[model samples]
Target: MALPIPTTLDEITADWLTSALRQSEVISEKTTVLARTVEVLGVGEGFAAELARMHLSYKNGSGPATVIAKIPTSVEDNRNGSELLGVYERELRIYERILGEIEVSTPRLYYGDIEVNPDAASQLERIRKMERLPIWLLRLILWFLIRFNKGKTFPSVLIMEDLSPAEAGDQVQGCDLDRAGEALEAVALLHAATWGDRCPQERYWLVSSAVAPRLFHAGALGARRGFLKNFGRLLSDHTRELYESTRTDNIERTIRLHREVPQCMLHGDFRLDNMFFARDGGFRALIDWQLSSFGPAVSDIAYFICGSIDPGVSEAEIDALLARYHRALESAGVSDYPLEDLHAHYTEQLLLLLARMASVDLLDLGDQDGRGADLVSVWIERLDARMARASSGR
Candidate 1:
């Protein structure tokens, strides 16, 4: 099936939603849309797409509640995949049939369909005219487009329970050894519950085969190369050696490790932004399952540790977080694996991380304050040091 060309926000309207929801029987005339806000969160340079979030308030018979709407920029900005309605249709099927059954915390999906918002039409036109503008200028224009699109018509939009980022912000500030541990524990539980001997590998393989190629082709290699070039200067001599070693390894070893390693359901994107913290000081949910797949357990662990933890965090703190993760894994019935084996697995996976990390735009130093860069450097350095120590002993 061909990919659906994405629709613009201006293309979405309330009538479209009303009609779609009527088919689903979730909302009716008694249901009123209170407020609507459009937010362009980020843009994907790799896919040349944008990530947007829509905040909507709706009143059912009793009162009012909020919902979140996500519309990929490619659909809205590029109009590339509209022809393939099945893209989102299949995603909805996965969410309802497979992901919904899993233990992982995800936002409640209400309805998803394709339509256009009239309010967005004018702004999107203006944005299109300003195509030659600098990125910062374009971003400003998009932000304005979001503000202008608010309270206008909503077309077909993917709706889910609205989650606030405030609590998550608080969690980052309050981050300590314990909170880090809880997050890792959550990851372990998610992995353990989703995949095991009891689960059908065919189901996951179906999704993986469909998705992995796109990811690899869609700037995965380019991203890795970009990250290395931009940040290679930060790596110590030891870290550089490990980076060089991975280049010498053949694809056979990479593929063998991927196949032989214990497989588990993966939260393909486990970065901090995708996770939500509850008001009561625990994980509320994990969002953005678009990249969910089956892969090595260490993939998720390495991504989280290297991507989320602040660089300012001491090595001692990192060690503690690692311990907490192991404890969490043990509690989840994943105790058979040795710590040394787990670390080695994580080390071997670093090359993959190095490859993928560079392609995407990381949270700015303002957002992560060199934390992500620091973690990556530290991992490289530690691996290099360990390899050297081993060689000396040999």
Candidate 2:
């Protein structure tokens, strides 16, 4: 018998919770969840799902009070992208299947499923969904490129043990040096465990080898248009000039560099908001596995340090952070990857990350007031400073 992905909070029964947990050995076979109060968890950043924290009442004394459920997003516009990119599919698979084979701290999976469909959705998913194709020949060519797709549109839902006991690092305020160090440790362990782990690569549904590779390619086509739109508000005249001069060439080079680095397990979206810290100063879990991939070590490292640099992190200090990551990697038995090579990779990742972050056409920092706006400003501030320093040959 196949299980269905629960689409809403009301659908999750105490019996289902008991069955799932008992299977995972989180609870004894005799133990069971009796009731639960579902509190929808964090929002304002990740748009893929409505995260609900379930406060449970158990029949037995040993069971936990809370578990987290990731359901489909409330935002209609974002749903298409989430589904098309298989975001939920990736996260669910990681928890239910892949994470068990790796040594990383993530929410313990209670239940997960990518719903099955017998439809031929993937055959024409790309070309058939094309909007206003003027040329028949071009449309036909695209349709012909992708041969056969048995892929169905599946709703990937995941339920995991709640980590609400820990504090999620703030992406807006950014992590300080100490928190950043903890994040590097979390990332190093993730990479080290799966540096050459063949488990993920064997899965056919997990084809995206890097985080949002399609977006990177599409964004490249429209880079100038989007960057120019948000340029005036985010940059000084000098920094803007500097950004304009090297931006295109750098993105071109770095995208290539990003693809060419040694492949390993990556927590693709390793930002502050996605990380939780225990009160004892230990990193708890890395959430939002939508972007998990086999890519460069610096892919995750660069992504984390870039967003988590408090208010003012000097370039030298940023370089030192990369060094800290290298040391941790070596501690985890990763040998021969020198700090100098890591530094070069970090620089390229930072450049590519900045260009992509700033190059989105729809990022109106004004629409989102408060912390959202503040995070954008901080990102742009860091971007401007870095570009300016590079231009000055500092």
Candidate 3:
């Protein structure tokens, strides 16, 4: 059995650092970290965990001076909900099991692990044992207190190289023209690397939203309703109607269309916030693998384009971007997939993409400024284009 996920910095001791360092091959078995100080980094967009920069002055001088640590957030609801969904472990497994196999650039992972919770229901049991009172009253009080806890026993943590020293792209302002192209190529290369590879999809960690049939319609409908409630004020009447028309069970539609060709792993979320760029206009890495799984690879492209490129970038220009992506995929050894097919997949995934941008909780996105407005405006613009194509019956 593995230890439960560490929820606080206190649990990540110097001994744990030395062990993890040895495992990551950062230092030899003879080296040891005599002391370490953890500095919590400022929270970034959609931060589901604590981001810390560790200052490690090693006695043997064989380890890094700085590294980033990822642990579950102190916010109980966020922690518990993400825990229930196994997103934390999903990321850890990617670093542990997938990164080494792929050609895509990501920050070097140092140490990561997840374990089952032992005292899982101890909190609830303890609350029940609280002093005698009316059962209903006691229950309600306990609920409020327990709500601050992750509720379940899933504990997980990850530590990797600090990308803070590198350039972190902003999701709100989005990436620039050159940056967007580099980002797209990075995506294409990654998809090509795992194209038609069945092992990843077969992994127990893979969670394909499109294949999760049990919750498709209910989730889609909820997503539709959520979009309307959260973003209606930000949309135009015609654009809103255009979005409403295509809000059908997107997940089901995606699965149907995606199966037409070989499916590969997708960056379920490929927005700018998860991107890091080199000063020379290349994608340094794609981070946040919590949503990495199998799907129509074009979903990653569409998601990136929607929020990345400037709103002024035309559909034709985006078509060129797709062409660039297709060529990159080919150069990466993925052959015979036509640019036409990529375009079609990109167009088809637009509806689900629309429903998603419209319905997902606005706050969860952490994009509420000028860039967010542009993202919605541009997304609806694409929706309008989709309507025109449908009207022409093309």
RMSD of each: 10.7, 5.4, 7.7
Better of 1 and 3 by TM-score: 3
Residue lDDT tens for model 2, 112-147: 777743332452344333423433443243223322
lDDT of 1 by residue, 1-394 (tens): 2123236664445555544445555677577555556675533211222345555556664221445556653433122222111233334445667676667677777766543333332533343355445544544443344334333222234667667653542213334556667778888887777555734364421243223322232333333455567666656576565555544342333465467676777776676666777777887777665555666788887667665555566655665666777777777777566777676676566655654444443223222344444444554443333343222322
Candidate 2 wrongly placed segments (more than 4 Å): 13-32, 60-62, 116-153, 196-202, 208-215, 220-232, 242-255, 258-260, 359-367, 370-374, 388-394
The sequence of per-residue lDDT tens digits that candidate 3 reaches over residues 1-394 is: 2334566888887888888888777988889988889887645455467777888877765777788888877665556545544577678888888878988889888888777454433433342344334434543543343345435555567878876556888866666677788888898878888887642754446655454432333334444555676556656565566566665556456667667856788888788878888766568998888877777788788777766666566667777888888889999988868888887777666655666664344224344553445555555554454433333333
Clash numbers, per candidate: 29, 0, 4
Assess each prediction's global lDDT (C-alpha) against the native: 0.52, 0.66, 0.67
The TM-score of predicted model 3 comes to: 0.80
The residue pairs that clash in candidate 3, if any, are 5-155, 5-156, 227-358, 227-359
Which residue runs of candidate 3 sit more than 4 Å off their true CA positions? 1-5, 42-44, 117-150, 197-199, 249-252, 362-394
Q: Which has the higher lDDT value, candidate number 1 or candidate number 2?
A: 2
Q: What's the best-to-worst order under lDDT?
A: 3, 2, 1
